[model samples]
Target: MEAHSVQVREACDRRAWVRDSDRSSCKECTKGFSLTRRRHHCRVCGDIVCHSCSATVYLRNTTSNVGRACQSCARPSPDQSTPPPAVYCVICLDPFAAQSDALVVTLPCQHAFHRHCADPWLATHDECPLCRHQLSQDRTAFLEFISF
Candidate 1:
């Protein structure tokens, strides 16, 4: 009985494999191509990145394959090189640098929020600035403790 089940599973798997192989295509242009001829598409934007064009990205302390971004459309301008610091306000997704007071505060959760942005933010939500981890709103309340 077990042998019969295993044989059936193998047949099913082989069919699926063939189906996938038939569907394989170029990552960028989406034209049908072979692995030897086609470059991997970038996971971010699904752009085709040939061998010379692919860029490797290291994420989550792990190395993963990523296609290189083309020069003109590639992200992170080398000439205008800005620090790769987090830009969005954790609380509002607003650009952090544009705040008038430069009063963006980093919550213990490693999330940054505008001092004013956080006060009202805290009233409705008591989480980390970025991931919204429930924070100590009443316990030894410090920082921009909102009165209202």
Candidate 2:
């Protein structure tokens, strides 16, 4: 039989209609995919998301564009055991890369502090590293009391 004749016979048996313009037909159910009509594009793959299935994409290591991703791919997995980079001292503008020689003096507002400069500076004053909240005398007294 001719190729076209064979194809026509097959299509007739399946009773499937060809939709050239509409791409939202669900592959599983052969029905309209729901999410496509509401949003501009698929939230995940940037494809034309239909009503039935639009996925959100979430990545742990990298940031993603919002409002385009769908739910199936949302909620990125937990990150690896690698710790984030250390913070730098705001006052001295020094990067705190290691724990050694670094004094973790906590501020009154519960902010991280450096010991090298803050300890000596607090000798005569009691202010926060950034906000300068008067904690120098109080901190000194507390330290002196603790040492005893």
**Residue 145, model 2: Cα distance from true site in angstroms:** 7.2
lDDT score at residue 118, model 2, on the 0-100 scale = 61
Q: Evaluated with TM-score, which candidate comes out highest?
A: 2
Query: Looking at candidate 2, what is the lDDT of residue 44?
Result: 34
Each prediction's RMSD over C-alphas, in Å, is 19.6, 24.3
lDDT of 2 by residue, 78-116 (tens): 453323333766668776546554655544243444566
* Superposed model 1: Cα runs more than 4 Å off: 1-84, 98-100, 137-140, 143-148
Worst 10-residue stretch by lDDT in candidate 2? 1-10
The TM-score between candidate 1 and the true structure equals 0.32
Q: Which stretches of candidate 2 lie over 4 Å from their true place?
A: 1-86, 136-139, 145-148
TM-score of candidate 2 to 2 decimals = 0.34
* Local distance difference test values of all predictions, in order: 0.41, 0.39
lDDT, candidate 1, 34-128, per-residue tens: 65766544433444444444433311111221123322234433464343455666656777665355566554344556667766656666566
